[model samples]
Target chain A: MKVIKTVNIFLAIAILILSVNLMKPLSITGSSVADLSDAECYFVNSGVSNDIPIDGCCYEVQKQLECKKTSKDYRCYTSESSERYYVVNANALNYCKVGGYDVKII
Target chain B: MSKLSEDMSKDVKLMIVLVVVVIILIFFNFDSYGVSGEAANTDNIQYEESTNTLYLDSLTLKQKIAQMVITYHKETNKERLQDLFIGGIHMGAKTSKEEFMNSIDNFQDGSIIPMFISVDLEGCANPFENFQEFPALNEINTKEEAFKVGYDEGKLLKEMGFSINFAPVVDLDDKIWKCRSFEGSPEEISEKAKYYIDGLQENGIVATSKHYPGKTLMLWDPHKYVVHAPISRNDLMPFEKSIEGEVSAIMVSHIIADGYANSENKPSVVSEKLIGELRNKFTGLIITDEIRMLGLSDYYSDVDQMYIDLFKAENDVILNFDINLDNLEHMISVVEKAVIEGEIKEERIDDSVERILNAKGVNVIR
Candidate 1:
């Protein structure tokens, strides 16, 4: 009886502690960030694309669309940020891969 | 009686306690479901056939402006809330059931026309402690489940005295992990959202599809940042689907649509460009996402102009829309003052009040 009482009291205490922990404020997790990469640097070096400039000290969005025979599962981060997720596709991914900084899959 | 073994008795005792606990939880669930809202005005909605212009004429310009402004209230102060003469009250999810009833009662008692009580029962963890926790829309997979969830939520909300729900975010950006969105392709969002819209509206609750024209990127939340969406007409398909599905209201976001809202690149809510686009598309209640949102607020140096511009852009309802009562009062005053100066006509205010009255089922015989 004594052992059972002791075990039940411990269990109650544990549950109480857990409820308190669950009520604590949670730190909101935001998305990850990265610096501009080398391929992007190469595109910057090649200043040929009319739509986008190669003066490239600043991080600006350049949208490039590529579609093939089959619409394979492709994901590009949005054509620009702040728009919601782009329709998941790879052409957008490749576009960001070539010229954008911090490209991500939608 | 046979002498039970000591261990067996202990086991029986534990089982009885577990059963009692389960019964208590069940009873608590019933109490949770038992919460109800004010039901005086909603029984009749013969709005298309007639309008109450007599009541409309009776309202002072300040009363009409108050009818246009919807504010978030945490407490149920009958005198103060009635004094504000606000048309709508957004009940926070955190408000307790008893207090929520009190708030609704005060609003009903205070106002001649019952205020449109709204809540965000987003089907995730409900913000209110006494309310039942529903699984997020993302957890729902099939059309049948979505309809059931939407119907039940709408019915419950009506019972709880909420005529409007700011939910089922139709934005294509599912990466933000708000769990408020129905994810997948835009088509999938449209298909699923139709049922949710129907479920709520059909049940007499106004379902509002939000963060309009699509919150395109997954990178940052608009609540914290000046979200920029460079979307084309093709991106607007989700809004089209939700509207077609018969949602009664659409909440526009403050996200700056670079290619869309205009060259000035104002957030869509205040922009004549985007809001004008919405007017072309939807004639229902065009509610703005909390007008106080940073995405829209940071742009206007003169905050009073923000409210003026929202209605100037022809936004029907402003949500949390003002900074404070003083700010709210000033915004109304400026709008009222503008009408008097002929910068804006009183007909515009009448048009807005008409929509609000119709939604609340305040109709005139003639």
Candidate 2:
């Protein structure tokens, strides 16, 4: 009886872990989004900001995603250069991400 | 016997559970677990090889118009582009070198005319970002270093089957990326660009000097849809040197210019006054930056009208990277309709197509 009960518990745990893994693909953190208000944006390289030099925080557009956060009204973008995600009001950055690109990020 | 039977049954149940867990893990390993670009249906297209003797008149209006467009390459839309006979394909970032080479070879084999496989291998804005590394332009201090970097980049690009490199950015000031441009005054930058262009061209790779009217890398406020720059005589020097060196192509920027190479407050790419002036100075291919840029697109209210203006502008090659294949097809049809209505002359299309064919090493007999 103990063996059967142990097997059931193990199986349940495995299934629960799998479900959680399948839910979130992107690692968008809920932390405060970076302040990119004064940051200049480009289609290729991350433009220089008053605070950050070009080398310090250059974000080259890796793949433009189709996800548009309607509440903030900004299109999603992914960069191979930086770990942190930015939500900027720049039309150049916003317009560039208006389509399906890298399959990894939608 | 009863004890042995119970043990065997328990083992079998455990084994079954183990197998189930393994199968579940394997299923999730596939890329289908995440969201990706939609798969396009290219079933109806047929691939045909081009003969050596391709003529100017042999191509139809649609094919000629198609030859003027350079669209982004997607794995699913390979056959669709092959069917359209696009002039060129721009590759985004890719990690595996073998896979990249194979994709280039596959597209080339399917095309009737050899396509210009282009990549942004500029020092800072590298498309081969993940697996490859190259010296940034600003890091080089001498002409010899610039030439060697160009030669090496050209050799690798040629080996990988790339024909056009949109590189050797001659922009004088690069405040945005900081490292995208070579360091120096206009004269020094121009000299390095000349040497770089020579090295790249010598290795059978066509070099392009980009963002033509200068100051494209300057920092700006993001609120304005279109930004204008005052281009000076010094700002024009690098492009002038590039022109003197016979660079195969020059990419026009979206900046609205006022001085020396005046774009007349319009994006340089779509300004006839600007392109016409350039045509007089250089006889090589004049390509535009991506037409989808908001700096250019936001200038007009209607998208179709923007397409008409782009063709009317007389750029030899148009870069349109709209992800949707339908919008690309729609742009083609819209241009075709404009040609039929005489909004854009058929002779103008012939002129651009002839230039495109000549660049592709095709002998155009008119």
Candidate 3:
């Protein structure tokens, strides 16, 4: 009876360890958002400032980011940047995360 | 059961537990592990969805970044060279035919793309290497001498496996570049550079016209801090001429051409619109001068982000980002993470690589 009880306890302990191991994630820190689907159009800032850069948009939907941070998910901007947006990746989006902006990858 | 048999069963149970524990450890924390050189770390990062086969798709993200940096070597590190997969390397001044040939051979041999083995043989007396001398550039009074200067320099560089020379400082300021420049008006510099540029390319070498838009005209040295030149597009005509002359690449200076597209007074290295304007005008690769220059140091307060911003600024090759491989790896890692995080597109990398490969005379895979 005691030996059977011991086996059950050991098995229970093993199972418990396995569950915890499975629960321990490698890292759950940053954004887990999938990149924007192919062919999605987005705005790219000609000027950069304190902005997070993003990528992966449908090509057809892409447009110019009229101003610097004024654009969605945009960060860096120059004072001269007016309300005019250039298509994303048109000049290799000059995104700056220096301001600790959580770059939203569109 | 015998005592030995009982002991064996116990050992088997312990072994099973150990195996289970090891397997669990490996499975839960395997994200850090990589199969190749510093690339697997980007497993979680986002990448450009370029479907075209440009020979770049086959490379790991690390190699893609490597393609964008150009470093120099007092002597080459072959394994680290291949490991980093750097695009090009320049040697200081002159090297003997033997040292140059050996390192260049190994570098090209180990590279998947043809390396842009380069040197800066700008003038007659090579101040950096002291290998040989051509007549001083400014002293060359006639057109034939300019070509002769280029041809002689090209012959020596070609024999030594040097494919690129940062020469013909097209900047019109004679005082800043001193003897290194053609020391004349923008028109004169352009006229001289045509023969010089042609002489090098025809001799099977590529020539790079540097200090874009005339930093030489600025009183302050960009090697120190931002020189607010505030020069207009007209001032940069010599660089345009060199570009039109079919020089393979134009090395952009750190000086701010505030008058031209640069409203924020930012160095051209950090300004997209400034570099973009240059890109619009010039069809070939747009290379940055060097990242280690103090002008950059004073330009950005955050060192780490400065490295990231260099790429964001859209320079084809980040010349002298860092020399040490480990330090270079850290720099590369920051870029790798940016790339994976979708701050930049993979096609952005592909574009630079294609330009670099084409400039190096490597047939683009299309």
- On lDDT, the leading prediction is 2
Candidate 1 vs candidate 3: which has greater TM-score?
3
Q: Report, in order, each candidate's fnat.
A: 0.00, 0.07, 0.01
Residue B128 lDDT in model 1?
44
- Candidate 1 or 2, higher DockQ? 2
| Model 1 chain B worst lDDT run, 10 consecutive residues | B34-43
Count of clashing pairs, candidate 1: 14
Better of 2 and 3 by TM-score: 2
Model 2 lDDT tens row, A38-70: 544323334443222211122234233222343
Question: DockQ for the candidate 1 complex?
Answer: 0.03
Candidate 2's C-alpha runs over 4 A off are: A1-95, A99-106, B1-51
* Poorest 10 consecutive residues by lDDT, candidate 2 chain A: A25-34
Candidate 3 lDDT by residue in tens digits, B199-234: 888888978887776654345531234567767665
* Model 2 agreement with the true structure over B1-366: per-residue lDDT tens digits: 999779768866875786587567647633323112323232332333364456566565667788899877676777778777788987765656787798899888867678889887876645554556677888878888889889988988999999899898888977755677999888899999988888898888889998888888774445664778999999899999999988999999888999888888788888989998998888889999877655676576666787788889888999876666656766776788789889999898889888887777776766
Give the TM-score ranking, best first.
2, 3, 1
TM-score of each: 0.63, 0.73, 0.65
DockQ of each: 0.03, 0.08, 0.02
Could you give the interface RMSD of each candidate, to one decimal? Answer: 18.8, 12.6, 17.9
